[model samples]
Target: MTVETPPERPPLTSVDQVNLSDWDFWARPMADRERAFALLRERETPVFFAEPVVTYATPGEGYHAIVRHADVLAISRRPDVFSSGQGGATNIPDMPPEFTEYFGSMINMDDPRHARLRRIVSRAFTPKMIQKFEDDVRVAAAKIVDDLLETGPGCDFVTEVAARLPLKIICDMMGIPERDYRFVFDRSNIILGASDTEYVPADSVDGIVGALLTAGMELQQLVQDLAAHREANPTGDLISSLVNANIDGERLTMQELGSFFILLVVAGNETTRNAISHGLHLLTREPEQKARWLADVDGLAPTAVEEIVRLASPVNYMRRKVTQDIELNGTRYRAGEKAVMFYWSANRDRAVFADPDRFDITRHPNPHVGFGGPGPHFCLGAHLARREITVMFRELLTRVPRIEAGRPERLFSNFINGIKHLPCDF
Candidate 1:
């Protein structure tokens, strides 16, 4: 299985040379993306581009490319004005009704609906709940490392190591049996990596949307079946808690549970895996930074995990819709307009961090919005994500300190800055 390298792109000398909505833009090298975003940030106001046409839905009006840190922060904080519910925060086009059936969770909703759903689900992600899983995370990471060692070097790190921890943790939290782990994993790949030929084959029967819907339906069914069982014979797992009703007597409907499960597995699994993969790649590229972290893995794990996330910006840009005519940092956005908050670009903005492109683990006051911006829609699984990254790296560096990542097989998706495969050796 050979990886096809993307063709060389011309240097982005001007903002006009770039198109945020183009699929080819995302296929460009990371340096080219950096330069292209830098040119956009140089402009006084956000640049607008036409929406990418998808087979599943019609492209709405183009969106403003909100690339700067301040602008992203402003838009994220003002959820009332910049709504995720109008269309959906995950994609540029208004989510088609079919897409929403499987994909529409709280992240795609507004208050009081968003707030209500979040309130119900937030219990599972509380500090106490996350702490309960801390031992499980350690045991999981150790076993993964043990397998990596037994398998020896030249393994696909993304699959053998990075992808396993998050997948297992999320599944375990939901009471998914070990027999169904691969079932959940494959479907997640299709849902997020649909554009990549590796996951949803280009020669498939129904194409991207069909593959997505099929995958979504499979995952929803798996969770629904589990939810039905959990409801009757309740367990301490998240699925049981969600299905049974909280102290407030609020419980998720079957449809809500299905959508939320999809969101949880997809978002929770994919983002953290990419972050871990990117962290290893970053450390490999910057050996000095790697050594710096190695010098004090336990002490610097928090900052190191954060810096990796900041640089990786795993989930990339999230789209928001303007609810009213609003002026943010002198740029005016009209009602019903779309604003794509490029968290990846904002993480590299010069205004906020000194030498923003540098991957320094000691980056103090690291206020990067890798987990989306600070608002109601901020990443629900953030604490778990941080813990996962930290534990995985700690286990790796302490046990396999010399491990290094080879060339990454990057995922060809604008929404996710993902490495589908990463070769590793020590």
Candidate 2:
């Protein structure tokens, strides 16, 4: 297969036209990321960034980087044209069939198939299930804060607090035994943080891929064993619900179940953890906003969560393949071409948001594509994520009002906007 960047025939207008495909760009500190995106936004709203070739898989011609809010929304709304099932959701090039099918969840499937899988999974998130989840979230949040209080505030907030609530809740929902909590957490970190040397050694591209696959397989095996047990004996948990769930006598195949489990483990656990981590860091950076939030967390929390997600954009960009020749604005894209929706940029688009860079908890009419734009592929756990953040912050601020967070140790990957470690003191 050919590996190349889109043919560029435009004069350079800015010095910051750095290729986003460079791993160094993603590994940069958060402050540098802002400057990079700002430069890209100024030079071109939607520009193409060629992906670098890798040892394990060859990245095909790179994707169109859609930065404008309108363009991201337009593409998201038209799944028929921009199909996730065509290309893997991540900006990275194609992987082996086993890896793709085993790792990709419903988010990677187009309609019909996507609808079928989503419908079954949707059954697991009924109103009753959600209420129970909320109750669990409140309890988990309280316990997490209580533990932090006992620890007397000087701790890695990312590991101790931000990662606690969601990981516990997700594990409990899956009926994972308490003994396996640490195992689940470790595997998740390895899966998402493989690109970071702190999580997995930065030995080589193949080594990194090996570690990721090993982590994924370990988690996949765990779920498979659990699914087998659940088959023989049903339980009152989301895993059981998914295991027994059927639509028109359709049930999730073992592979689908495994993929779904991985999705929940990675997406369900990682996204909220990163969001909570960023929330605390943001509050620490802007004490005025923190004070405002403390004043009325309940009244302002609904919008506050939106703002956090808008700013955090934990899952940065998702890839889609063009199904047919189409012209987006003035750029012509052919069939099989790729487009990456930069949620991090779209959330900061000046055209849609006034003072888009400002962190305002009271920002209303927030049409940010933080949870992704309105489309069939919109985040499935968005409601749960919001509730988790709201309740977790409410508990933290109410109990540890003087909490202070240090600079975040960001993850070294373009895929997830993650914080590996965050020091905090109250």
Candidate 3:
């Protein structure tokens, strides 16, 4: 998979490189990410300076940049030394100690506990289960597209279609009621928007935090209610499966259920939303590549989705705390320090890619870190995410002619990367 980053504009200066605001986590625009990574890659070392305490793993006391593609693989694979527990899970400014207590959550846990929780959740998100949801995703995507078509051609696609579609689909899979969609959406915005000033915004910070706390409690309560319901009135939705599921012959605790729900909501909605919005924006920006797919009109949209994920790299990076003193990417760090794997940078490493900036949908040997990481923490929702994007492109590229980018609004956060407004005047 020899891909190349096609050269473009110069990297942003350090002043422009600093991330600020509440929405920086999941809503950072694709263009800004390219600028930031381009600057981060300019230094001699593949890795460089990222103020750890300020950017990622904020509560803890260390920061590192394993910017190269190879280094990301090495650190991710060796979870023993680079434990995911503690401040690595999120870049939250002042991480509440309460959140870390339930540190056994799959994303933060290492070895036995991580393994155990992953196993429990893995059963529900299998290929077979996703296959069952294919029609549901298509139906939902079609409805979203049709709604856009109904309102005429020119529309802000990201806000209307991209953000809402997957939110519904994931909620459906999780067995959350439709009445709760607004609530779920609110909390997702808050938790993911915690970093950048753009997404959650200064005015909404208090509301966002308060909403997130309430949302977590609601999820905990819902899981218990659904668990009791499933025990008596067993239906086969994800919630039911979780309630009835047995790990080591025991059901998960309320805290475990909350974390699992958080995982699905945070993981499922934000990434897919970014991929959809960013993909549309890319097609508009790169006419030649967009034209190539529009001409094909068959399964080519799926290929475009892959390119979007590869190039957009919606997940900025997943942080890990080093358990013991270790050396990686020619840099050394002590125990309890944080190593943030900058996926956005690694995906564009010059050494691993040839002319790495070019977007080639038909790039045959695409070994992108967009989905697969080197080891166990690979995204469980990869299949489902792919389904949502594929269905969307199939509906969108065919329905909307000349879907050009019209000034994408950026999210201020550094964690969850995405576009807020992709106004397309089709």
Candidate 4:
């Protein structure tokens, strides 16, 4: 896909120019987005904006744009007052009943239900299992690099390099067959890229919602079939373990399994994919940093991976419903209201990170909320994502030490800071 030139936006001279609800706001240049959020972060109280209208769901009361690092951390810690389940954490607008069946999972839930699901899933991510995944990540990264070398450069880095490792790792963990990899990849792109015209026509709300639901249903059906088979004849894969294991007399229902799988694949795939893509671009732009990392690839891998995620902030914002009237960080929020935590902005908060815009791999004490804030909703796959990034970059820098990224074709959506395509050369 071609990278569409972003329409010229007037300089963000005033906070009034910043509207988090505007679709056009998201499509603006990256520099403009940074300026817009910086303006929002300067305000004493969070700015409230009317919810974006959609045909599938009614627009509720406007949501506060939580841009500061401290506020994001505070609201995350107080899950009792700010709930993820009243409507959903994934979207600003209330998730309609129909959307919940496939989209709803532990991420959009509160305690008891969230705890139960988390507990069940956590059992599968045991130390031994994680070690196994790490081993697989190394092998997968190497294979991906091997293919990239054979194909040579001038390829879309997002697809050729960044998207491959996470997609393969997630699919393998779920016991998805090799033949079905493309099927899963396409569906996930639709689910997350529905707002982008390349994936779904932006003709109407009906078209967007239809594409999303169809992708979700197709994914759920695929998992259900695999889960049914796993139930009868278990294997060493995660699907088999989830299907047969009993955790404190609790088991994930087929619907829960399907939704969780959808969450795992999409969340796991997209976040790491975007991070890797952004990492390449960051390294390319800051060649000195790349040289610094290349001097000691193994030593700097951990810090480099983190710095990339902090800057990438792939899954941009998560919405929460105010459960009670409360005062947090000198701002009062009424009960039955909504607050959207912009992780991307929080990561760039000046109060937290010194020289936040600079790509410093050795950025110590990096308290970035790229993986969500400190709460129960913190990303379950964060460890895996870090591992995937570290391994992928290690392989890339070691093999093709001079690789550089070209202009990126970014996704046109507010939800995810994604690069649909990025050219590369070595």
- Give the count of colliding residue pairs in each prediction: 0, 0, 28, 0
How far off is residue 358 in model 2, in Å? 1.2
Clash list (residue pairs), candidate 1:
none
Best-fitting candidate, scored by lDDT: 1
Model 3: worst 10 consecutive residues (lDDT sum):
20-29
The predictions' CA RMSDs to the true structure, in order, are 1.7, 4.3, 5.5, 1.8
Regions of candidate 2 where Cα sits further than 4 Å from its true position:
1-16, 43-45, 126-128, 204-206
- List model 3 lDDT by residue over 59-173, tens digit each: 4443676667888888878888887765535552335665543223678767687787888889878899899998899899989888888886677877788888889998888
Per-residue lDDT of candidate 2, residues 45-72 (tens digit): 4778787555457788888888778888
Candidate number that wins on TM-score, 1 or 2: 1
Best by TM-score: 1
Ranked by lDDT, the better of candidates 1 and 3 is 1
lDDT of 1 by residue, 155-266 (tens): 9999999999999999999999999999999999988888788987767788888999999899999999999999999998889988998647777899999999999999
What's the TM-score of every candidate structure? 0.98, 0.94, 0.87, 0.97
- TM-score of candidate 4 versus the correct structure, residues matched by position: 0.97
Candidate 3 Cα errors over 4 Å, as ranges: 1-36, 42-59, 92-94, 101-104, 196-211
State the local distance difference test value for candidate 2. Answer: 0.83
Model 3, position 90, has a per-residue lDDT of: 55
